[model samples]
Target: MFVENLGIVLALTGAVLSALLAGIGSAIGVSRAGKAAAGVCTDQPEQFAKVLILQLLPGTQGIYGLLVAFIALSRIGLLGGGEIAALTISEGILYLLACLPMAFVGYFSAVAQGNTSVASMAIVVKQPTQAGKAMIFPAMVETYAILALLISILVVNAI
Candidate 1:
């Protein structure tokens, strides 16, 4: 009984930690992007649409993390039956560890991407048609976030 309760605790901890990290990361990203957009708009008002889209790109990581957390919770039967199973210490640790990388990567990458997007918006101010090209750097930065999400998902599944 104690072991099962421990498993439930570990699983809930992992899910909550993962969600918090992702949320914080996305929050940082969105904040940076919004600031950049505001800065850009102050000068070139016409680039609002492009800048807004760019700002929104980094915000997706939080959503992905939330989804993964839901999956993890569902897998552990926390939402329905509330029944818990015993997990090996290693397995529980792995689940927690897996979420770390994604959280770290998502946070930094989003901030970097926000900076990149800001630069891109500056470029757009001069060459509106080149906005697409300017987005390449931010897109590249986003790849790591996707990778982190993949790793988190796989780890959760393994647990």
Candidate 2:
């Protein structure tokens, strides 16, 4: 009965979830890091540059999510090619499943990265000279997001 519509539903669901979850994570993560940055900046105005960079670290997840959503939408003909209604149930489901890893991982990693950045901000607060080293901690969390992005892109392209 709903089979004809299921394809578009699944495809749209995947695209929406990928962007929505990742954006939420980035928003929360950036907010937390921004609060930490504000606290640090209030104490030491000179640390603003370092803290700002750290605070922005989690934003990459949102960009990754957007990329995946764009690719998925394009591949499934929602953004280009034919009409979105032309997608098959199997193809839509495949796209949906392919997006799950990035959606889940991106959300969790961004939040974790934000927390890590906040902790790293403490390091920057005390040891200003070690800001470069401190940045590495939060940067490490980005690995998983990038991996997830890569996998999602590959899967979307493969489909």
Candidate 3:
């Protein structure tokens, strides 16, 4: 019983932590992108479409985290079960460790992507067609987040 409860606790903790990390990352990224967009709009108000896309780039991480959490929850049977057993200490520890990389990577990647988007936005204002090219940086950062998420999921499943 205790072991099941521990599993539930660890899983919930991991889900919440992952969500928080992704949410915070998106928030920061959006904020940075918003600021940049505002700056661009001041000079070129017509580039709204381009700027909006740039601003939205950083928001994807939050969705990724949410998906991961949902996957984890489903895997652990937390949603349907009335009570769960606690995990073994080793399992709990493993779960925690697995969650860390995604949280950290998602956070910093979003921030970095935000910065990249800001720079890209500036470029887009000058050359609208180049916007796609500008997205490469954020896409690159997203790869790391994806990798982290995959690792976390694999680890969780293994436990």
Candidate 4:
């Protein structure tokens, strides 16, 4: 039974890591940005809406991670109450590998975006007119998360 279920275990590990690591990264990023935003808001409450947007930017990676995990789980018959599809070890490894890009990239990108977001908040502090441009900086970091999402989706679906 252990041998039979090893594939499921491996695949589940991938899903868990994707969700857990990305979620953790987002949590850290949001906390850091939120702290900076609160400091800014202490003097300028009017900036809450703008800073909120920037603070939330790092969170999308967690959502993307969840999306990929959902896709993987649904495909593996682990969602919707279906019996888990019996996967060979090689196929399970593929699932693990597929998830790694999102897991690793999402984690790093979110942290990077958070740091960028904090800096962007500084722009809001001095020149509120450039809030749009401030947002663009963090959004740039999102591109890599999107790329990882695409790769995970394609690879998991391909499997």
Best-performing candidate as measured by TM-score: 4
Instruction: Output the better candidate (2/3) by TM-score.
Output: 2
> Candidate 2: misplaced stretches above 4 Å?
80-82
| 1-159: candidate 3 lDDT, tens digit per residue | 666567567767887777789879989998999999998889888888788888998888887777667766666666667555456666666666777777777788888889889988867888877878877766777788889889978877787
For every model shown, what is its TM-score relative to the native structure? 0.86, 0.95, 0.86, 0.98
Q: What is the C-alpha lDDT profile of model 1 across 49-119, one tens digit per residue? A: 98888888778777767777787777777667876655666666666676666667766777777777777
lDDT of each: 0.77, 0.91, 0.79, 0.92
Prediction RMSDs, each to the true structure:
2.1, 1.3, 2.3, 0.6
Report the Cα lDDT for residue 9, model 4. 78
lDDT of 4 at 20: 83
What would the per-residue lDDT of candidate 4 be over residues 112-140, giving only the tens digit for each residue?
99999999999999999999999999999
Candidate 4 whole-model C-alpha lDDT, 0 to 1: 0.92
Clashes of each: 0, 0, 12, 0
Candidate that beats the other on TM-score, 1 or 4, i.e. the better one? 4
How many angstroms is residue 110 displaced in model 4 relative to the true structure, after the best TM-score fit? Answer: 0.5
Quote the lDDT for 16 in model 4.
Answer: 81
Q: Rank the candidates by lDDT, best first.
A: 4, 2, 3, 1
Q: What's model 3's TM-score? A: 0.86
lDDT per residue as tens, model 2, 21-62 = 998999989999999999999989999999999999999999
